[model samples]
Target: MVQTVQSADGTTIAYEQAGSGAPLVIVGGALNNRQSAAALVPPLAGDFTVITYDRRGRGDSTDTPPYAVDREIEDLRALADAAGGPVHLYGHSSGAILCLEAAAAGVSVRKIAVYEPPYFTHHVRDEPWEVFANKVKTLADTGHGDQAVEAFMRHAGVRFDERVKQEPWWPAVVALAPTLHYDLTLEADGVVPEERFGSITAPVLALYGDASPDWAVASAAAVATSVKDGHQGVIPGHGHDVPPEALVPFLIGFFHE
Candidate 1:
């Protein structure tokens, strides 16, 4: 059954947990809800009490106006508290950036792992950050959620094909378009904050798929070196959307270490 926790600002955050062991919270990336991590849960369930939650402004969770990255950190802190102690936190894409920020902000997490955070040590995209940011923000704030989603996907190298549009989850993804702004906010210029991350004493594992672009690999490496206790891993033949089979082994090994 899904449960609820009140964030520091009183927005209700919805979540569910399974299995029986140390708490392991899985944070979804942009356009994702709790269901995004559904496939990883059962395999990890045997060793951990896997927890997945809808971030504020998406799915079963409710949002407060005036989104702030710190508020998102508080949401994770609330989940960590609800788990009764520190947790093993895992995040993907923009969610990975949030995880690092939370750890740096002193959330009680035993360790953190991230897959393919979009940060780049060397800027890759030709579009100026301000131009891209404003374009997406205007589109989302003007009630053109579908357009905002399209813009984000296109910029991220995701193809906007008819097959993708026909998927049952496409509407759900578009409905989450506004949260794309929040994800961009978390990324903040798409560079790793070395000084900010230095504050995180917890172990961090930054993983990238072998098949991903060189920029992603470089970013992941930068992230690993930024934290006090950080490591990097490569999952063979995977990309941003890493399969559970390729990902679970890394989580099991890292969290256990």
Candidate 2:
């Protein structure tokens, strides 16, 4: 069912709630909306009241002026309250970064299960991200929205099938590409502040794909140390866009444990 909740800053956050049992909020990474998570939902929904939503400025959610990371955390807190409080957070890509950030910022969380947050320690450089962000911003500012999406995806190293260029969802990516700034800003040079990560006290299950970049394992392992009870999981044949089957066992074991 479609529902709305007022974020701490009064922005209206929209979400779709399905299935039953414990509440689990699925936070998608860049360019992801509820539709992008449809395949994983059925499996998780069997054991959870799975909630998938559009982050602000994407899909059905509203955006507030003067964006800040704190505001997004407030958005998640609002959804958790709406979902009966202290909900589980299942985050993908940069959404996992937001999940960790939210828990560190003191949002009520029961558990966090994240897949391949883009936190890099060794295999990435700091300078290119700034350059990339500028190019994307310029294209978006000059109204080349579709080009902006392509540029962002390319810079992020996503190899989409050529068929996607002709799909109906291509337009959605074009529309949401501007939010890349929000996602990139959350990375903060691909490393969060020590105190900030040190504050994550929740039990975290961090996952990474074997087929992802060489830094994926290193990044995941580093993030595991940030949380009090964090652990790492591996998917043998997946990348940043992990196959749902590769993640099923981890989700079931962690959430049901």
Candidate 3:
């Protein structure tokens, strides 16, 4: 069953938890909700309490007016408060960017681990954010949500053809089209803010798959080197979709240490 927590802005954030011991929150990337992190729970559940919540505006969570990344940090703060003190965070893709932001903003983070934060510093985007944002906004605002989702997916290198559209989960993914701007905003210009990262006091672990794109690998390295106390690791023989077997060990080792 889902539980609720009230963020600073009074938005009701929905979440579920498993296991026991210290709190560990898993923040998923764009188009993902609380359910999206379910695959990771089983393995890590044995070592820590796993909390997976829907980012506001998706799943059972409610959204407030004029979304800001700070509000999302407040949502994380609420989760941390509910966890009963400082909490560990593990973020993937754009979610990792949010984690870095939260930690830098002085959220009570004990430690943080991120996987491929999607910072394209090494390989810049072809078009400016305004152009892409307008296209997605227009598509989503005009009731062409499917097209909006497709545009974001294509930009993210996801295969969104007819076969994918026929899947049952496609509609849920499309429904999250409005939040694409949230992720895009987090990634503004695709440059990694090294100065902001320098402010984070928590130990940071940046991981990228060996088989992932060169830019992703470089981004992880840049993140690790930028922070005061950061480490980078490679998940060998893996790509963006890292399997639980390969990922859990690294997480356990890092979070436990």
Candidate 4:
């Protein structure tokens, strides 16, 4: 069944519950809602009461302007609390950053699986990110959601002619470009605070694709090193877009252990 919860800041966060065992929350990558992880949930439902939610300003969730990463973390915490206590958490891409931050903030995450958070070091420049953020905000403000989405794809290293043309969610992501800038801004300002990963006491499992960018691999390793009981793994034959089926078994085994 689907359920809705009003965050402390009045945004309506929507979530779906399935399966029948220990509660587990799945947070999707940037520009994706709960449905993005659909493939993994059904199989997992057999052994877990999986919870999937629309991050703020997407899907059925309401958008509150002046977005803060803390607000997003709170939404996750609210869902976790509702699920009982100390539930397992999993997040992909930016969602990984959120899950890590939530765990560090004393959210009672029993175990966490993070998939390729894009935390770059000083070697990486923020100029491109800033430029992209501005362009996206302008496009979204000017009613050019399509263009904004295109801008986002370019920033995320998604090829122009391939996935964008064939994937069904491409257009939908473009339609929600207005929220894309907020997502970018949250990450740029270090809202997730990469330096604070050491504070997370929960056992963390960090996953990265063998074909992912060098910076992504480095970031995942850095996070794994910071956590007290963190482990890192590489998904073979996958890039940043790791397949759900490929990851489900890993997650089930880790969380169940």
The candidate, 2 or 4, that scores higher on lDDT is: 2
Per residue, candidate 4 scores C-alpha lDDT tens digits across 32-129 of 88788888888899989999998988989997878887888888888988898789999988888888888887887899999988776633554666
lDDT of 3 by residue, 59-170 (tens): 9999997979999999999999999969999999999999999999999998899999988886867688789977887898788989999899888877767788899989
Q: Alpha carbon lDDT of residue 80, candidate 4?
A: 87
Model 4 has an lDDT value of: 0.82
Residues 1-257, model 2: lDDT tens digits: 77888898888888998899999999888888778898888989889999988888887788997778999999999998888878899998889999999999888898999988887767556457788777777888788988888877776787856677799878878888778878887866777456777877778998999899977787788888877788999988888878888787798899888
lDDT of each: 0.92, 0.84, 0.91, 0.82
Deviating ranges (above 4 Å) for candidate 1: none
Rank by lDDT (best first): 1, 3, 2, 4
User: Which lDDT value does model 1 have at 12?
Assistant: 94
Clash list (residue pairs), candidate 4: none
* Pairs of residues clashing in candidate 1: none
Give Cα distance to truth, residue 44, candidate 4, Å: 1.1
Of 2 and 3, the candidate ahead on lDDT is 3
Residue 198 in candidate 3 has what lDDT? 92
TM-score list, all predictions: 0.97, 0.94, 0.97, 0.91
Cα displacement (angstroms), candidate 1, residue 39, comes to 0.4
